[model samples]
Target: MSLKSVSAKIFAKIVVLRIQKWANNPIETQQKVFKQLISEAKNTVFGKDHDFENISSFENFAKQVPVRDYEELKPYVDRMVSGEKDILWPGKPLYFAKTSGTTSGAKFIPLTKESMPYHIEAARNAILCYINETGNAAFVDGKMIFLQGSPEMQEKNGIKTGRLSGIVAHYVPAYLQKNRLPSLETNCIEDWETKVDAIVEETKNQDMTVISGIPSWVQMYFEKLQKSTGHKVGDLFKNFNLFIYGGVNFEPYRAKFENLIGRKVDSIELFPASEGFFAFQDSQKEKGMLLLLNSGIFYEFIEATTFFDENPKRLTIGEVKTEVNYVMLISTNAGLWAYNLGDTVQFISTKPYRVIVSGRIKHFISAFGEHVIGKEVEEAMHKAISAFNFSITEFTVAPQITTSEGELPYHEWLVEFDNTPENLQKVAEYLDSEMQRQNSYYLDLIVGKVLQPLKIISLKKNSFQEFMKSQGKLGGQNKVPRLSNDRKIADALVKI
Candidate 1:
């Protein structure tokens, strides 16, 4: 083995040991982070306004700080954006992660010096943990590619600002620089399709071992490679063995990926965002991600079922239970206080606090009180495809509340198939049955005659890509919502 490969294996062991210390003491580690965040920012503008000086415990902190989303927190953020110091954190942030927002044009999530390292380190540790568990560090010697936004950044009031992926691009460690690809010039291409084409040309003959990106976008890259070389991805890049992905469930896309690659490969799922790097898959045998407790972020959970209640109960890490959906809230070292991240998660294991991102709080279909979530829809789709031995390229679900004639409103599944089923109606009925089985409220609605069985609409090739392009979000961390409450997405798909 090369010297670097040997060193990586040794270093991976050390990192895993350090992580185990906190992973085994989840609550205590979180408490220390909570105290440290409060102590460090006690003199900042937000800390003083929220009375952080007298706050002694989780209860005290919770009582003093109310949960705020991006819109609610904009007043304080505006001051920071205007070049004010200590408005939220102890000093000016090193960077602002620019992300698209629904109401606002864009959101600038501050990344302070203290909190930024955790984001970079968490990503590194995920791979190290895998190496420690499986004794495979050989990929470290081969080429790696993370399909991301351009590293080109803009300066806003003296702070560097860009998309989170682009901002992260600047922080790739020196050790990986030699192995990382598409060349800096190609990565800076503004158009995603053009960028992927450049990437294909740049790395077509290299010994690529690690390919990472959002699954949907990476699928597009793989398709382009196959079209160019007329070979499966595995044949073109024989060493490509690890696939790292985030931002969506991988199960729904697994069959399609295996088909494209011509073989099965190990994969890692990450739960990262502009707000914070929360969790990552730590075990190949496990179902969920290891929640980071000592990462300079204090977490609170409000049960998703009771999230809209007047004054719902807020629970700390110690109080969270497995299998219950909760809206994740965080008070971070980056100056966000009791911030609502909007993503809902369910704990798969609480022994060391591992969770799976279930869905976004606002991204659900509750038009008829059925309250179906992203996880339900994704799981239902996966089950249906598996049962019928079919494969799909992409899909999204939305409710059609206004139907013609006397029929009840129903969910419309817009699916792009790689392998069509022999019986479309039978597959749709199976999908509907699976959905009803997963959600009791949905079952109740179906039984009570309030809604009809879901209808599947077959979409042409590249429909989702066209839709994304129409919205000016074709690639670079963009993804189609798995489920929406209304027909906005469904209508667009039909029109396309």
Candidate 2:
């Protein structure tokens, strides 16, 4: 083995050792992490405001600090942007990670010198854990491509600001830089189509061993490479053996991706956001990602079903149970205190604390009280696709509430198809049935004649892509919202 591979194996072993200890007693590890985070920030403005010093326990912390969403925390974030020191954290943040803002306008989340390493370390440990589990360290010796956002950043109030992926691109370890692909120049190109084309030209012949990106963008890159070289991705990069993906569920696109690659490869799912790297798929045998309990983030959960209640039950890592959907709340070294990150998750394992990303709290349809979330919608779509023997490029659902006097309200789906099925009506019927199976509220509405069966609107090729491009969210950590309560995105797709 080469010296580089030898060193990588050593490092992976070290990380795996540490993770083993952390995983053995997750509740204790999380408690210690929460205490450390509270202690570190107790002197800051937010900390003092929330009486953090007297917060000796989780109950105290929960009682003292009210849960806040992005909008609620905007004033402090705005102050940080305007060059305030010790306003949130002990000092000004090193940078801000800009979000695509599907629910709200653009948000600039803090990335501090103290907190940034957590992101890097968590990602590294994810790879290390995979290596430890599978004995696959050879990929480290070959070229790896991380199809991420541009590294080029804009300055705001003396702080560097860009997409989290772009900021992370600037921090690729010096040693691994040699094996990374898509030259920095190509990465800096802001336009998605232009950058993807450049990437295809640059890495088409390289000995790529690992690839990482959001599933949709990676699929696009694979398609472009196939078109240019007239070869499957596996044929072009024979060493490609691992795919690291985040920002969306991979199951819906798994079959299509297998076809594109001409074979199946090992895969890892990550739960990284602008806020922090929270969880990762640690074991090949496990269905969900193992929560990073000892990371520089303290986590809390509120039952998602009653999230909007006047007084929701806030549970710590020690209190959360298995198989219940919960809205995630986090206190991070990045200076966010008891912040609701808006995503919902369900724990599948309580011992090591493994979770699956359920959906976004805001990305739901609740018109007429028939609530439906992204998970249910995706599940329904998955069944429909399988039953129809077809594949989808992308899809979104919205509630069509306004109708004529005689018409009932219904759900509308805008789907971009990779393989259009012969019978769309039957596909729509199956989708409706699957949704009813997943959500009893939806089923009751259908049975009561309060709502009509879901409608499927076939989207032209690249319809969703055009819409994302128009919204300045074409690539890199941006995703089309899966379910919307309103017709804003649905209307745009129809117009397209």
Candidate 3:
């Protein structure tokens, strides 16, 4: 049926408010909305055993809730692995969007029916914002492809059901719902290559109007697209209109995509979790992304610096400050309250609360007093790769400084690319320049002897996914966790 009118109205109605909400709202308005959400969240889960006595008792109550890893929620998480039905949601959940954990074993985060409306709304808001700003709905007018894992959902009775890829197909825009291209499934849970052959078989020669999914998988998708056809990357997607991507940093793979499509991709970011979709790029051309303000759940941010504190404190929607980086904290209907999602981001401006992802708190590098985080690495890479425009297919950095008589550890990078000349030295030189530009402390430390120069090593073809697969962490939602901060990934990257 025609959600065109509904879609048009939804997208149009929020244009001004979304812009205002993302950029610079009145402080009082922000606080009022924040407080209302807090009250709504409390009221939403009041009888569900999430006890928050009052706002004053929140600090201590926050401490009382255990800091949980995915494994801690294994039982509930299993239900979400892949399937249509689970206790995680109120109604039957439409799909099981698979994401990996520390290892692949089971980071199966369930998307609950109780919470999918928010995801749909956020996605709508992003599309609407883009249309209002750039009039780019032509991106949606074409055949959209979501490069996700299998349609598998874990069941309470211990069997996975529905393809994760299948579930998303069911829930996306109805106009495109019937036109979803066939997905590469069956082995989505096994590892990466299982879907490689399938990715190629399906994507080849297809007119992909809009493509969205994890960055790594997207890279792999087109790489195989190039290999299978014996042509360059652009040959596979010449008809591509727009590319929407998320779940990992798009910097590394962007160049490759440009080469393959032979065009400047119109990209948008989506911030959805296994639990639910949160926010996305509202306008096609804006510094800040629009916040899905009234989506199913309420969102809040904790100061990034304070997130790792022993007694980490959380700022309410009204109380949280902006512009600085903050770890994402969500109050979702999916059995999580004040949940620390581990990812971090920065506020571009808050009138409309547009934010740019900084990086993950746990995925940080602390070699030799250089607390290098994902955002630092991403910004450095974004600037350094400006000339080459070479999409970084896969990359990881190991922190080690040359210890000459107690020398500190430095960063050693391993990158995979599809290019003619593989000049490691040139890549390293530019990386050093970027490091100096992005982080003054890092530059000062390099001069003062805490770290050494950066190193870039290119990997053989198809090595990245092989490395991820071997570790049982390869799939749609999972990526090659760029800043490993350890030797495990280095060993894995080199071996692959």
Candidate 4:
């Protein structure tokens, strides 16, 4: 916050712009850059010192590296936490970012001081872009919010054990640090009740320049705030800065936030995980998020869906199908290689390489976005529909559309239930509100009443068995996936 520090950051911002300008075409830029990083990763994995003067040397080393997953990095975590300095990046590491995916259990990825500089750079670049794009940086004069994980990290043998958020928080700019809002979930001490009781009073009047965290928590918190005080957030704060978040999309909960303040706000993206901050929106355009490849990690793009009779193929940055979905693979400075990130993405543009989140590749419904992931749909619908002394024990959602026809105009939501009203017309209105309250795109794409209403599936006992039998994943890790690609489940849910 000092003049010297501020001036230095301004200089760094200019350098980033110059570098970004040179990478005009993201496809070519990624291909050339990735090949270099890939080469360095290979050498690093095999025990080699990096010649930091020129990054190209690391690129050369990546060629000899072998692909690895999280399980393969256990030895490094143990050694690094033990204070050994020869692991992934040189020097003592601060903390590991905590993340959990489909294949890997909750993994705390190690972060060294050398790599931390880049992590800060990549994330800060995005923040700068948000400021430049919206011209809304003036709000920073107020307070900003980050709905981060807990501020606690476990320590072992004088070294901290656990994810990087706590460690990263320690390193954040001290002035900015003063404005961070604590998490309602993780910041708890059973024996210390006074601290828990104090957060509400402390946070009640903080100059929150930025509000960031999980969308679900963000939505739930604001609702709680309103219900508790009977006064909206706008009445409390005259100028709320920005909402920076990760882990999930904010489109679903946009309505609630915008409605609360009576003004629309732009939300920024943060893709950091236990792995690392891979990419962030470029702070140049309306949604100019860019991939930070040269930082501590390199990336690989894999085919998301192969034809029924075709083989799976790995695509490079150039080969990524525009507008098609892909499974992301990571090779990070923390010693993780070729690890598949369960989320899916769609490339919207190649110049400056842009992407739109399609949905979870592992989480799908008949290949449609409607394939609701997690138990939210059942929970939301149950709360909305079961007011008349009725409740839902089990339910499922599937997309049923005439794929065989020309550009099927609409998709239908098939819902199964027992002991419900015969008239299912209200299904569309109620579920739509819940879905829209959750994702903004769902509201945008499925607007108007063209799509089929929520077709209630009144099920008989043991009927869900037939449903489970149809998916082949029943009783397994896959479990009858809550969302499906076809509407067969909804079609049958209406029958009983």
* Candidate No. with top lDDT: 1
How many angstroms is residue 411 displaced in model 2 relative to the true structure, after the best TM-score fit?
1.5
Which stretches in model 2 have alpha-carbon errors above 4 Å?
102-104
Writing each residue's lDDT as its tens digit, candidate 1 over 28-114 gives 899999999999999999999999999999989888999899999999998999999999999999999998989977999999999
**lDDT of predicted model 3:** 0.63
Q: What digit string (tens of lDDT, one per residue) describes model 4 on residues 345-370?
A: 66656666666554455556434344
Ranking by lDDT: 1, 2, 3, 4
lDDT of each: 0.93, 0.90, 0.63, 0.54
RMSD after CA superposition, every candidate: 0.8, 1.6, 4.7, 9.9
Q: Write the per-residue lDDT of candidate 3 for residues 317-361, one digit (tens) a residue.
A: 556556677887765555555566788877776555767777788
Tell me the lDDT of candidate 1. Answer: 0.93
Summarize candidate 2's per-residue lDDT along 269-305 as a digit string, tens digits.
Answer: 9999989999999989989998998878889999998
The TM-score values for the models, in the order shown, are: 0.99, 0.97, 0.81, 0.66
- For candidate 1, report its TM-score: 0.99
lDDT, model 2, position 333 = 87
TM-score leader:
1
Cα error, residue 199 of model 3, in Å, equals 4.2
Backbone collisions counted per model: 0, 0, 36, 43
